[model samples]
Target: MHSDVIKISDKDIKKPKGKVFVVYFSSISNNTHRFMDKLDVSDARIPYELNQELIVDKEYVLITPTYAGGGGDTKGAVPAQVIKFLNNENNRHLCRGVIASGNTNFGDTFAIAGPIISKKLNVPLLYQFELLGTQNDVESIRKILEDFWGEK
Candidate 1:
């Protein structure tokens, strides 16, 4: 099936209104949280210790970090908190896309969570970046979100 999720590229230069709603899960290291802070979009952070399920009322992009097991195993790559958040049917339905973060040192598993979630949820993997991302990553993602949501 054709997907509406926008794929970001270098050519997308629209100005972002910072209106896109982002939902993310950041581990204790806060790599994902730190990355989200750099972007101007509205966001909610999924607590590492989730006591209640989160339900997103509107469409959003999910940003999460990879947590691959030892020995370069892909298992447990997607954070448990992220899995819990996505367990809700409403939240799953509203997930427009995903952006994953990881360390390049992990090699083959770098940002693997993005692809896994994208396939499971049938949404696009909008982007992936190393820990905290760069200034270019922030600017590009903001612009892409604006263009995708037609808030440019």
Candidate 2:
């Protein structure tokens, strides 16, 4: 069976309506942090910082990694800290979408955090990539962000 993934180039990605905030957590392998670096844009912050002040406005995308267990035995779920940060009612409105990361070894549970966040937060699960991601993954993510943030 062929993968149904569509290949999008950097040229295809458009400019944003405004700024796009990338919120991520990198506690374990830090692969998600590495992936964010490849994006090469500066509008990013950690969840802890945002919690200090309720950000009721602005467009943001969550980029987080799935933990081995959801702080316990539930594998492939969003970490507790991330959930706490997002739980703030004010922060919920600012989130436009999500991009999740996980290890492929997790199999079907890989990057499951993205789906949970997207559903609970009422946003789209923009992308889910393996740890650190690949060159194509970076470019594709750029395109998705650009398109999502474009005039609309």
Candidate 3:
């Protein structure tokens, strides 16, 4: 088998209408970078910041590592930061899809980011992947993406 799984709601994972943006916000050295490497990109938030008010008419999937208070719920609630970003965009209709990625331990952290992404932007969580990071993080990621997009 060349597949995997992540629990998601019905609202998430819609086939987007236009071009897609794979936005990644990384802090912990290479985890974020390594993950992004396994995927293809039409465009990326490499600078990880967007032009103010540039409503992306294309679909988007966000992959961000959970940090700050640390893994899942420190009860720290930094998920609001993502909401703030969406609020700043003020273009809910522009987002046709949503996704998040983080270490498997902080499962709830990124999981929480999903609904908030939906509520804040009124979008949907297309899917999310949590990595415990085995001996081969790259291969783990490749398997997951292969499962999701059925590409490479």
Candidate 4:
């Protein structure tokens, strides 16, 4: 079996002032986790358990997988863990933007969580990708974050 691993160079990782970080919630499928692994940046994962505490004190971007299914209603699109994490007043205030992952097969509901959270939090929906995402997605996200944070 051939194993493929992406090695990130130190120079590729931007060390922005004030340390804008990435926070994500991945379900059992772990597709969002796989996507986050491709980016070279500081990140925290929202635990599956609602009782777990995760308080991000600094500005950060949130990456989440959309879970909505059928009829394009967007009900239950955002994971409970993500909702719990964002419900924290501090966390909600510190969030700078959001990136969402979803299967396009869901039509209008694809990546719905991004827009929903963006509106609720008054943050921008930075990006959206399907499933694990491609290399281009990773590069675009890198540039987006660098520009958003005004890399020093």
Candidate 5:
């Protein structure tokens, strides 16, 4: 095990410093986790549990997978545990970023999870990106994260 940390000069710190959190439901494609890991933010990829403290945090990027007949959507269901976690009142005022994973075969299968996350996060939707790949999706996701976070 190892610790990874990078320190920037004071000049760099002046540009809107904020924490990042990822509310992920399922990482079947691992694209979300890959992006979050690249972000280097203290995050939680709970395909199971979420709590009030999660909402209180300011910088959050929630990623949820779309599903229908049992696949990316977690057995064709919207993991109620995550929904309950979002329903918390403390989660309001969250800064937004989103990444959705789904099959492009469906019209909007890969991009609809953001609204639900936005409502709960109470954020203005900073950016949303989608990824659709069978096994190579993770590599493509890294580029998207770089484009998203590297932007001014």
Candidate 6:
């Protein structure tokens, strides 16, 4: 681990700065939702739960589960909801980055959704968290957002 990375507890994660949004989709297990809970940002929303207007007014991060490629392969597919949302030309500009979740048991394919999103959407692959995420992962995410937003 880098020296700059701090370990934050669940209760101590800092909220994202500026007009940040976290769009996610949780299917099968609730692990994606559980990971979203670790975020201090209040703009967390599931695609299905959102209204007709899928375009966010500000820059945002997408957190979604890997729907395919769970073996030793590194190629993974994005969730259906996320793909639909991203398919909208209007909504594409709102995305700044992505965080993908997957089981480590998948080996090289674990959290492969991030790369797929990053490549397709032309955005950064910010982080890849294990199922439900760890407290350390949450803290590292907080730090990354802070740095990205130029916040202290």
Clashes of each: 0, 0, 4, 0, 0, 0
Candidate with maximal TM-score = 4
Ten contiguous residues with the weakest lDDT in model 1: 1-10
Q: Put down candidate 2 lDDT per residue, 1-152, tens digits, no spaces.
A: 00222333546423234865677776655677778889975455554443343343566788888876332334437777677777777667677778888777766567778877876776767898988899999999888887787722
Worst 10 residues of 4 by lDDT: 1-10
- What lDDT tens digits, residue by residue, belong to model 1 across residues 58-141? 788888998874355789999899999998888887887788888888877888888888878867777888889999999988
Candidate 5 per-residue C-alpha lDDT over 15-114 given as tens digits, one digit per residue, 9 for 90 to 100: 2135334566554556656656555545676544444334445545556665533233423324455566566655433434555555444443344455
- Per-prediction TM-score: 0.84, 0.76, 0.55, 0.86, 0.51, 0.77
What clash count does candidate 6 reach?
A: 0
Off by over 4 Å in 1: 1-18, 69-72
RMSD of candidate 4 to the truth, in angstroms, is 9.5
lDDT of 6 by residue, 108-141 (tens): 6777888777776667677888888889988988
Q: Candidate 6 — which pairs collide?
A: none
Runs in model 6 with CA error above 4 Å? 1-17, 49-53, 72-76
5 against 6, candidate with superior lDDT: 6
Each model's lDDT comes to 0.78, 0.69, 0.49, 0.81, 0.47, 0.69
Pairwise lDDT winner, candidates 2 and 5 = 2
* lDDT, residue 109, candidate 3: 55
Enumerate residue pairs that collide in model 2.
none
- For model 3, give the 10-residue run with minimal summed lDDT: 1-10
- What order do you get sorting by TM-score, best first? 4, 1, 6, 2, 3, 5
lDDT of 3 by residue, 8-122 (tens): 4655655454443565555446566666666545545433334433344455556554443344353433234344455545434556445555544444454455444545555
Model 3 CA deviation exceeding 4 Å by range: 1-15, 28-30, 46-57, 68-84, 90-92, 107-110, 131-152
> In lDDT terms, how accurate is model 3?
0.49
- Candidate 2 local lDDT, residue 123: 73
Candidate 5 or 2, higher TM-score: 2
How much does candidate 3 score in TM-score? 0.55
Off by over 4 Å in 2: 1-17, 47-57, 69-76
